[model samples]
Target: MGIPQVSETVERLWNGWELRMVMLLSLYLQIFLILFGRRRKYTAGFWIGKLVWLAYLSADWVATFSLGILAQKIGDSNRGSIPAFWAPVLLVHLGGPDTITAYSMEDNELWLRHQLVLVSQVVVAFYAFTRSWWGKDPLLFVAIPIFVAGIIKYGERNWVLRSASSEQYRNSVYSEMNELDSKFDKFSNSEFFEMTDERLVREVDLNGIITEATFLHEADLFFQMYRVLYADLVLGDSIHLATHIILRKKSAMQAFELIEVEMGFMYDVLYTKLAKVRKSRVIFRASIFLCFVSALLAFSLGISKNNHAYSTAEITISYLLLYGAIVIEIYSVVLLLFSDWAMLWLTGKRKPLFDSVYRTICSSGFLSFLQHDKRWESTMAQHNLISFQRSKAKLTSISLKKLLGKSNIQSSKVVGADLKKFIFQHLLDKRTRYNLRMRSHDPGSNDLHEILSERGDEVFGREESLENFVWSVKFPDFNESLLAWHIATDICYHDDVRINGGNAKIIHQNTETSIELSNYMVYLLVDYPFLLPRGIGKERYSQTCSAVDDHAELLDRIISVQPFSWYESAITFDIEKSTRKVSALWAGVKLAKSLQALGTQDGWGNERKWKIISEVWVEMLTYAASHCGWKEHAQTLTRGGELLSHVCLLMAHLGLSEQCLTTSRLD
Candidate 1:
């Protein structure tokens, strides 16, 4: 028998090999999209972000290209070809990944463009199906339902993008408030005011002990408060209540977890179909499930009926496409089940069945892996320009290590678990004290700065005169103060080690936190200067660098003479005079000396002295964070977010932000 071959027309119009390659490429892109879309939320390293960025851009392009190829093949071929059978699968791919609908906030604004693409692609897909199937191709039964499901999925994505856009979010919030107001006016003014105030007061029990359950309930109740963040609305009594009911009561770890869940909800509201899915969750899930099942059944029936008509390669590709769609749908279902949305649902339920399921899931190890709260597991990254300048050789070595894909060289410098707990506890204590003071006085009686200063004095057991010396008069310029305090902390930290001598190990824990935070703040100063208070000139930074460089020779000599000696050992070479003549380092050295002297004079233990310094730095950090513009904090969400931004949001919620003062004025 003569060798069987494809006809000349078929070979010229559409090659089987080319169609297969495109189909395989589309599948590979889908796999990449699904795997890496959510990785950014957990891993904020450079390489991971780059890979996710690449995958994000390519997923849509590859899917669109495959759809184009399928359309072309169907139009060109004399008879219906296998590639035509795959057009609906392309539609499914075009729906995009569930993990990310909009890559950034701006992407949400392009929903109309996505909608246009949706319409055009659906037309092209339908045209391809008509050209190939006419009335004969049984796979059309499968294609029709899958096509519908794909359109629905794509529409859901567009809807989410639109809803998440800033304008839309603000409008939604305004509409909700207006509706509430309209309902209120239906009652007498006195009655309405009494009922509303009662509702607000009854929502949270201020005197009651706060547990995880209570915190969760408060989070749900304060949805309106959080929603205002997106709309840039001024918070009122709701935020003050939140502080008393939630923020002040929880331990640091619990507070952080609450914030994590809150951020997770924000992420969902801004980036995914979560808001839409949440409205008709059960119905939506059932509808999608039915579509998948119907598509599978239709595909199975079509294949069984026409098994002999299609080539083995074509049949295998068909099966792969069907199964791939099924797998993606299943994965999305799992994500929905494990998300904070599920937790929210569980929190709202009164049913025994849901409560038991929630308890079981919360206790399971699997929940840890599924939880999408952490942006990065490490506390925060550290990058100090001054430290880098001090050690060029070490910088070169770190660069090499990074190039070789080694872990962070400063990973050891990450805040230890014990230190984190201490910082949290100290901050919580300060907040509690501040809250008490506020309650004891009249509302709006003291400004934020006055309150902070009073709290600082109380915490350090210092009178106003001593507080003025350490913080007020000596550190008038924010940047200069930061530089001086940072250097002072470094000096004291090294000096404390030498002073402890035989007991260095015992005192190391106390000094380590001070050193870490000092460096972290300086790192922020250099890398993210915009976050700090303004009005400090660049000359101040230059002067400090000059002072450090001027003392380099003495520093080297001190290091050589006493390899393990304290940094203060170099001060004997008129270092104090040079620092004073050159820049603010003089103030730093004096401050360090004063702190040490006070600790000795007051018989404050090594732990007690370091605790005071740590608390002071934490206060400074929180002040700076709270002072930064909300728009600046919002901008960080696209770059994998930051702890500072989270802190700012927390501060705003607790009615501690200066931004809140301005916002309140607007009201």
Candidate 2:
């Protein structure tokens, strides 16, 4: 059997006219997406553009059959032209350049690989173009605008990156100005501001500065109590909010983990609600069916003879390609429709559910409930045990003479003014400066040995009191473990320590309280604010006040902890890391707020802007506390909301200026 031949004329028409038109259209679509798509709406543009490009690249196969048929009519004997000129060109396009790729992040990586690919593709494309001298020069014309558009898109992205740095700098300076105004405004309205007696929210002078050291110290002071407020949240209480925030922050893996945790907890909460489960199943099934039907129709049309299919081999391949696409679309649509968002809404009005769950977590009256996982429990226990031992030591002091068995020298007399002697004589072999600070006096060799003995016993569970203790020390381990414990500290203790005017106690109390209060306030604003008191006689009002006080104390403590010797450590906590931790807590709260808005009478149409504004307010609050530092506490308000507000003001001014510029340009 002789192979069918494709005439040169038919082959030229297939490549020059049909293929060029499709490629040109795809390029235009990509350009449209780059200009109009919102930052958050990239998913829509990405998939659509991807599919269009795929189709354009695959269209050659579709043209092959028609060209072969035309050639056959012309009585050509040799097999049809392979369209080999396009094959290499298409390969070059697939490789992409340094400026563009399949992903946005890839553009930012070291460009050696991209440059190599770029050079190779350029060479390959030129070779293909030289070979592809068809009767019409359709590709050259089509490529021109496509090339221009690609350059513009690449340049625009680069401009955004370069411009954002300056924007942030200008934003910072403007923020500072706005912060001064806010402080003045706050000070002026001090009378209008309600005062609280709780240790956490006790009004304190900020001393007119915001330094990094102070910021971290203050954050440390209150984050503990905030962690407790969302014990349920931290331990996986509100799955919908937690899951949404995780996904929003682009932490899909963590979001899935949170979902698993939520599902397990929900199974316990909704154990009796068989009807809800049945409803979910029905929705899931229906969505799946619809997706399947759409995909099957699309696939069937693609495989039909009117669409493509030339030789028996080509027909088989085309059917397979169509089948794969159909499968992909069906799965995607099914997943989207029955997603976490849909299932959550279908779970019925869950505002009350969220509230009930939150309250149960918060007011269980069991402090133990606040700790998550065994590691946290161990850390807390270490904190408590140390405090308890320190209290016992203060209460029961042994004289040096008694310890020396009636020796003439007193321990205090021998130690003199040096506390190191006191510590080493009684407790451990060596002592840290922090240990001396904890004692409120220097520790000598005897004192050190005694302290170490007590510490070891507490740590190793040598005594019953030590074994039964809830926390081991005032502070636990120094690294990730201790910090995590501080985040879950109790509010009452913080209040007491603040009243006592003790630094060690205040430090512990304040850091935990502040972080907790911030987290609590966000949650209240977002999900459980109804539990908060409106004006007076609200049951949770006192609790809310306490949380706020703790937060204020946290802020104060952070200011006090400033001027750390190593400022580099402070700068290491860049925006991304700070925001990651902030976002994790914010996610649950954001979900709650969104849900609360939805459940209201008007369905949230008018309130969307305000809701967004509130979130901005919270973001500002945290960012100020975390980023602006103790010395720059005054600047905290500026970097966030005040700064953003200032930018809006600038844009307004800039817009007027722009209009004037345009008038001048026209004139």
Candidate 3:
């Protein structure tokens, strides 16, 4: 008898609290998304991303579930008026945060499905509102403005999602290019801006003064011209011709800054509600915020007169939902004002006052979070080959770790200043010059890609001193080649450490650049293999790591004490996993010997040898950058992006793309 009574009482409370619980959960989800969704653009971590991902997926379900519960309670006279008023509050949560419209690029492709669900949900929302207290209740009348705001919010999400889809995005790009062609009837009509030879980019009409606003406009221009690259489309050779003519004149610093701005635009296009820059966005912002304010005012007044009739819990929840929503909506509108989209549109208008104030705030750096992110953390994750082995060499298979995407890495470093300049200048001079000559003369995408994707071998052919080391690139699969080079680079780097007479001594700049690029490549292979050319990289990597693990003590001794040759006792070349284990270590040792021999062969110093090694690594990096598919590049933008994606976009602008160097998207 006691158990039965307890069960009955528990069921009663659950039935009463189910709708309220779901309502609060849906609001909490909206709060979570508004606060944290933007972090995925700039933060790099597993747990933060997972939390936001969970919240993004759950926000919609809870809102829809709340509506279903309300639709079921339409005739319960005491609760009906409260549920009816709360129904539209659920719709505002369904609108989601302005910071996130789609979680991934693939989510944008499913806009039609979202639209169908939107229609069904709107039908249910209306049914629940109209069935209860229609003409009799003042609460139902106050819900009218909230209902309108909810529809606009939900519909705006679907619109942005649709605009970001591939077919819609590509069509818009083509239409804008046609408009550009119409505007440019003659070269003489175009006005020169940024007259400095090192930073010049073509603009239509402006005084020669370059403000912070000018960078936003410049980013808008570059994004318009090159945005098609993100979607894997081809551009006409003329767009290629026009871009390279300007890019070639830029210094490495100016060049990277320009690319950073363009990438910021790409991030907005993929992740946020700003799918395209337009004046219509301003109007939408005004409409949504005004609707929210009007609803809050009407609801507060209506509820006060009927305050005695509703339950205390019902009144409290209604106030929380209203006040919380208006606060969030106000912040969203302020974010829109400070967004790159708003700044871009505002900058384009030459109307005097807005442009000056906008530029002043941009340069002032008052709200640093709102500033267009100039660099994303400026750090690269570091996962060295031997270090990975030393850390993760238990008996379990690596296949599971790969499947779950658990990285063996826990270390990262700021991308060194000189390393960035070194890579920028190398691609600026070598890859661009070579790719342009080939593509302009012959335009076969596949054949051109195959030829240009020579990872390190081409560098050998170009440099006379490194001809003897060409076989290392030629003798293995690309993955094997990476392992071989990584092994050799590590050995040579340690040898330099010893040669400096102390491990703490600052080495040559070229040696530091070589090791940084080398370790970064291994990080990509281990953690983000899809960004690399299709390869046996992970398999080869695991085997090489095992090799280092087996002989860690001996290897350490060789580095700190004796010459490498004294460790011959440790070698047993089991040929089955030739690219891994002992055989792989031998390959590295042999290559290291060859590099050292080359350093001593003539009048060349350590600087000459390190320069060759660093140049080869840069070539390998660019080769991987170009050959990675554009879709992979687009997907990485959500995870704070990758250095390889940054390089790939810059490569396209300089005519070194794996594609035919033809794409244009301007809106």
**What's the distance in Å from true for residue 36, model 3?**
1.4
Q: Say which candidate scores most in TM-score.
A: 3
| Top candidate (lDDT) | 3
lDDT of 3 by residue, 318-427 (tens): 77888888888877877777777777666666677876867676766655756555347666777777656655655376664466676655577676567778877877
Question: Could you tally the backbone clashes for each prediction?
Answer: 0, 87, 5
Residues 1-667 of candidate 2: C-alpha lDDT, one tens digit per residue:
2333456667677644454443333333333332222111112122443543454334323333332332222111133222222322233223222112222222223234434544454444444444334422222232232223223323333333332232332343354334323432332112212223231122322222122122222222122212221121111111111111112332223222232222222211111111123454455335533433443454355446333323454334333423432343344333333333233333233355543443453345442332222010100001221122224335466765446433211111111122222211211112231122133222243242233123222332442432322232221221111122222223223323443464544333223333333333333222222222222212222333333233333323322333322123332233113323212211222222332333243533323422322222232222222222211211111111122111111111111111111111100
Candidate 1 stretches greater than 4 Å from native: 1-19, 42-46, 78-80, 133-138, 175-214, 275-279, 363-369, 372-378, 394-409, 412-446, 449-461, 464-480, 500-508, 526-608, 631-641, 658-667
* Candidate 2 weakest ten by summed lDDT: 374-383
What tens-digit string does per-residue lDDT give for candidate 1 at 1-667? 3334556656655565677777877877777767667766655566766677787788788778878877776644453446355887788787776787877778888988988999998898888888667535546666777777778788878888888777888888886544433432343322322444335435443223223345555554444456665577654433443344456556666666566556656666776655423656666556766787788777777778877656788778877877887787787777788666676566456556776787788788888777644444445556443454466444434454466543322432544467557756655655554442234234465455564443234544555435545452235567777777777776666566555563446565657776777677666665567777774535676677777677666544332323443345557446666743436666776676677666665556667778777777777777677667755665455455666666665665565654343212211
Per-prediction TM-score to the true structure, in the order listed: 0.79, 0.22, 0.88
Provide the overall lDDT of each model, using Cα atoms, as 2-decimal numbers: 0.63, 0.28, 0.71
**Clashing residue pairs found in predicted model 1:** none
Stretches > 4 Å off in candidate 2: 1-107, 111-116, 134-140, 148-667
Find the 10 residues in a row with the least total lDDT in model 1: 658-667
> How large is the C-alpha RMSD of every model relative to the true structure?
6.3, 27.3, 4.5
